[model samples]
Target: MPVIEIENLRKTYSMDGGLSVEALCGVSLCFESGEFAAIMGASGSGKSTLLNILGCLDPPTAGRYLLNDDNVAALEGERLAALRNENIGFVFQSFNLLSRTSALENTELPLMYNHSGLGMTEIRRRALAALDRVGLAERADHHPNQLSGGQQQRVALARALVNEPSVLLADEPTGNLDSRTTLDIMALLQQLNDQGMLIVMVTHEQEIGAYTRRILEMRDGLIIRDSPVENRRHARAEASGESTTRLNATES
Candidate 1:
């Protein structure tokens, strides 16, 4: 079964003067387990709107979204929040770390929302493990201001992974990083995908999109192009100054 499945997903915003602007006009998509996919588009192309719905941050105006076969539209209030916390992990462009908190504390934020009744020791252990996965275990006690941009982003990634979510959602996660750091983060994302964690990312940069196995381009609230990357760029190779090449062609 697909990890995520959406059928005719639609979202519209009611603006001033009884005007309604459609953000997503019947987008249908399916993401399988272990897939590394990128959503690409220009500004106002609805990519962000789709990501919001997928992250459970917003509800679609119409249609169905199934996460692990649970009807997302059917969940409400605390149940929806719980579902999102349990299954969806989010990383954003801004890093979104609490500057006053330590890396380990930032990572434990997600678990704090969890209703599983976990003890503090267990939460700390999971947070530390998550930081280790993102190569930031040694910086567990460092505050956000003490870390570099890339390191801060890694902290955000660690926070996302601390929940052991079924899927990782990243919105322009590398936007604030330099080119070198961009590749570094992409390499980490690739490694996570290789380890069987499903990842869906939003990026407008063509070069950045090439690092993913699949790219879906949206325009005017619709996915105009959904194709497997013909020449996937391996971030590890790029980071190591080695040329890499791979080819495949498939369409969604």
Candidate 2:
């Protein structure tokens, strides 16, 4: 079954003078387990809106949205929050780590809220494991300010993954990083996806989108193109100074 399924999804915001702005217009898509997909668009193209809905941060104005076969569009309040915490992991452009907190503590925040049944020892164990997954186990005691941009982002990713969520939602996760750091982050994301994690990322840069298996191009609140990437760039290969070119140059 698909990890995510949406049909004719729509979202609108009320404006002045009794007007409304359509942020999403009849959007529909499905994402399977272990698939890596990118959503790309210019500002006002509805990509952010789509990501917000996908992350369960907002409800759709109309339509069906299913996460792991559960109808999220019909849920509200704590039920929705529980579903989000249980099934989804989020990474934002900003690392969103607490300045004064240690990386391990920051990564433990999610569990504190939703997994209260877990003891402190288990929480610490899981958080440490998560940091290890992101290649930051040794830095677990360091604060966000002590880490580089890429390392901070890795901490954020570790926090997102600590719960072992079924799907990962990244909203411009590499937007604040330099080119080399961006490639490092992409390589990490790709590695996670290869391990059966479903990833859906929002990015405006075509170069960043090239690393994903599929790209969904949005324009004016609609998907203009939903196509497979012919020669998906491998970040590890790129990092090793290998040529990263499309198998079919015309695929884009």
TM-score of 2: 0.94
**Candidates' lDDT values, in order?**
0.94, 0.93
What lDDT score is found at residue 5 in candidate 1? 100
Per-residue error (Å), model 2, residue 227: 0.6
Error of 2 at 34 (Å): 0.6
Expressed as tens digits, the lDDT of each residue in 1-252 for candidate 1 is: 899999999999999999999999999999998999999999999999999999999999999999999999888878789978899999999999998899999999999999997899999999999999999999999999999999999999999998899999999999999988998999999999999999999999999999999999999999999999988888888877632222222221
Lowest summed lDDT across 10 adjacent residues in model 2 is found at 242-251
TM-score of 1: 0.95
Residue 209 in candidate 2, Cα distance off native in Å: 0.4
lDDT of 2 by residue, 110-145 (tens): 887774588999999999999999999999999999
Query: lDDT: which candidate is best?
Result: 1
How many residue pairs clash in model 2? 0
Q: Which pairs, if any, clash in model 1? A: none
